[model samples]
Target: MANIIITGTSRGIGFELVKLFAKEGHQVLALSRNVQPVQRLDLSNVHCFSFDLGNPNDFKKVEAFLEQWNVVDVLINNAGSLLNKPFAETTIEEFERVYKVNVFGVAEMIRTVRHKMGKEGHVVTVSSMGGVQGSMKFPGLSAYSSSKGAVITLTELLAEEYKETGPSFNVLALGAVQTEMLEEAFPGYQALVTALEMATYIKDFALTGHKLYNGKLLQVSNSTP
Candidate 1:
């Protein structure tokens, strides 16, 4: 079993990922703003840490916990923020909030745990199809989509920086999935995929797919544009 760290584990896709990884007997460190839900899961293989990804100061707690671990096999940056509003009405604060959680937070987490990663370590950050140019662009998602685009760029840069170091970096530009975030962003609309299904694919990818590609941005979807 490998040691894995997942962010935003309290609910949605992150919550499902915790269940799948714990069921597989991997040592999972789950981080979220409120970890009570994960604690209630009652999985011995999973440990919950309460921290807000939008706040960089809170990352110290994650760093402290990872300091005790000798090796971390995978780091899944799943925590994110979404702001669905017309560009005309979007405020600077909203844009910063989205970037703080989706971009800066992910970068800080990787920097904190990178030293704990072993030779085969993998870092997988969740992106979105909305971030892909010429894919499917949606209005009222400029801030959120832009933040995800930054994540994909950052992943590529890290992969190149660490090419000789052994750890692999990749991003998954996911399509619409049935999660609370999706419902909030696009109310009354049903998605083609479920959180559990997405989590399963992500778990498999982190464990096995990393070996196949590095510095790659994968588009996970069932339909074509």
Candidate 2:
């Protein structure tokens, strides 16, 4: 049983991830902007916390909670924001908001927990396939994609910097998964992959992928890569 920290667990992929991990007997620290949904689940192994990732100040609460656990086996940076708008029409505020949650938020979370990670610790940050240079790009996702691109770079740098520190870092560039976030970004579009399916894969990867993969950017999709 590992101690896992997963963010954005109120719903969607994060929610499913919490369920999967908790059901498997892992101790899960599930963080979300709102904790009501997680609390309603009443899972014995899942502990819920509420905080806004866009605000770094909110992480102090997370730190306090971590003080009690003392050790973390996996940290899944799954919280994210999306803004689908043409670059010409996108405001600076919108761009900043995306970066706040997608880039800076992930950085702060990692900083808060890095020292508490055990020898088998692994850090997984979820990016988007749209963030990849050669992947299919949509015109209106400049801000979102740019922020995700930054996450991939950040993960790579962290892995290299912490190569001998025991905790392995990796990034997962994911394809469109059926979730509220995807539906909001692309109305009426159907995703080939479901959030539950992605969550299952993530659970397995978080449990053992670090043993063989580090500093790697993996692409996950049901479509042809």
Candidate 3:
């Protein structure tokens, strides 16, 4: 089984992924700002790590933790941030906040674990359908969407960097999923897919020996199942 590191595991998709991975007997390191709530899980294979992903300095803490464990076989960049304000209305601070967590945060996590993940591993970044075509009009998504775009781009560059190696990097551009992020951003709007179902699909997809997905985007919609 793979040793996996998942960011933003306190709740939502990250939390669900931790459950699924641990259930499959894989060693899971769940990272979040506060992993206390998730620590109650009875899964022996799952370990909770608390830290702020948005801070680059916080990665040193993660690095120290890695010294105690084996090389991680997979790294899931599942944590994200959103600021629901129109481009004109969005403040620089808001934009920076979103990018800190959604873009640079993922980058730092990958940077910290890249050496540990050598050849036989995979890196999956949770992007969004908003990043796919940019034609769709979603008010206040400019900051968040652009950050996801950055993630997609990072995936392509990293995949090429590791081309000779067996490790793969891909982005799962999910459509709307019912998660706390959705509810907090779009209060009354219903999601097209449930987070639990989304997690299940991700787990199954990751397990599949599909090398074609490297440096590519996989859209998750009603037809995904």
Candidate 4:
């Protein structure tokens, strides 16, 4: 039904999202550093490609893909890097690496595809509960949480800057979901929400959320991991 681009589609919520959209007959571009998982699916109306959010060259792949279809109806910035180490032990390079994927990467993707998105397009960025101000904070997530926070601010600014032109922006500050990323961040912690559940919510929102929301930060958390 729409031309949608989703990152971090190798696993978790992103992977589920690809399936849902393609099953609904939408044109889907599924991007991930590891594309094998998506390739294995071989779903109809879906294309998989290897992409690195931290690599500038990889963005050209997105542009190349867009040559087939100029417009992007929806973009879900779902890729993220997490560092669970203590703040004191976290090096500057390590911190930058997280932001490279979580912060700067989101910015680059929006800038690269903004032209393709008209007033009706929507950009949904997946953030974490730790990124929300006054939300429950976690230990050993300085880099990861801070980077997510920055993306939220960036989304707000982008929405304000381009409100008149269209392509609204929104950020979803999610709580713990039972996904590999969550396990890597907090071992043995089981979240109430499943990856599929979150993915379903996100897909539904990305398709229609822009109609009512722009430059808004939504806290989508029910439990902690």
lDDT of 3 by residue, 1-225 (tens): 888888888888888898888888999888899887679896788877678878888899889989977677888889888788879988889999999999889988888898887667889889987877743647778899889888999998988888787578988988778888988767877887788899998877676533556787787765211
User: Would you estimate the TM-scores of all the predictions?
Assistant: 0.97, 0.97, 0.93, 0.98
Candidate 4 off by > 4 Å? none
Q: What clash count does candidate 1 reach?
A: 0
- Candidate 2 lDDT (Cα, 0 to 1): 0.91
lDDT of each residue in 83-135, candidate 1, tens digit only: 99999999998889899999999999999889888669999999999888778
Best by lDDT: 4
Question: How many steric overlaps are in each model, in order?
Answer: 0, 0, 0, 0
Output the worst ten-in-a-row residue range by lDDT, candidate 2: 216-225
Task: Using lDDT as the measure, name the better of candidate 1 and candidate 4.
Answer: 4
Stretches of candidate 2 off by over 4 Å are: none
lDDT of each: 0.91, 0.91, 0.83, 0.94
The residue ranges of model 1 lying beyond 4 angstroms of the native Cα positions read none
lDDT tens string, model 4, 1-225?
899999999999999999999889999999999999889987878997899999999999988889999799999999999999999999999999999999999999999899999999999999998998888788899999999999999999999999999799999999999999999988898899999999999999999999999999999988764
Worst 10 residues of 1 by lDDT: 216-225
Backbone clashes, candidate 3? 0
